[model samples]
Target: MAYRIAARHPGRLVTYTAETEEAALAKWEELAADGVPFEMTDADGVRVDDIDLEDRIDARGDGDA
Candidate 1:
């Protein structure tokens, strides 16, 4: 999926997408390579769920698999 980048600065750079984690990171690196300074933010952080996070009980070794 391509992500839309909404930087703090307007008209500098915006709106991008990456198919994978590597691609997304590459996009940031690409921007950095071009000497562009910007900030990364979660534009839709509240509406998104982090699939990477596991339940605390399961991680603590007290839950059944």
Candidate 2:
């Protein structure tokens, strides 16, 4: 599966495909840490509900799988 991070305001999109969720989350965090506001979604353009960016990053570090 592919993960996507897109800017909510201007609609900039960044797509990441990784062998594992951890790797994807890592890339997401890297982009987020740059301080741009973005929303996470799946490859099909569906929003990844229930998890905020920071929380999701934390979850990955905590091994929440």
Candidate 3:
């Protein structure tokens, strides 16, 4: 599934696309780390909130396995 990440400024919109959910969440983490406000959506155009992304990120758990 495709995921879209977007951030809107007063007069501009910035967007990024990811082919997988993991990539999308990574992008979300990057943006959050940079203190950028953004919105993420699934292929079906369903919004994915920060809390949901955070949960998924936590589940991934640093890939030490």
- State each model's CA lDDT, in order: 0.44, 0.58, 0.80
How many clashing residue pairs are found in candidate 3? 0
Report how far off residue 22 is in candidate 1 (Å). 0.7
- Worst 10 contiguous positions by lDDT, candidate 2: 12-21
Displacement of the residue 19 alpha carbon in candidate 2, Å: 5.6
Itemize residue pairs with steric clashes in candidate 3: none
**Candidate 3, superposed: residue stretches over 4 Å from native:** 9-11, 50-65
> Which residue pairs of candidate 2 clash?
none
**Best candidate (score: lDDT):** 3
Measured on C-alpha atoms, candidate 1 has an lDDT of: 0.44
Q: Estimate each model's TM-score.
A: 0.42, 0.43, 0.68
Q: Write the per-residue lDDT of candidate 1 for residues 1-65, one digit (tens) a residue.
A: 33344433345556564444444555566766776655433334422112221232235565466
Clashes of 1: 4
lDDT of 1 at 7: 39
Point out where model 2 deviates above 4 Å: 7-19, 49-65
Candidate 1 wrongly placed segments (more than 4 Å)? 7-12, 41-65
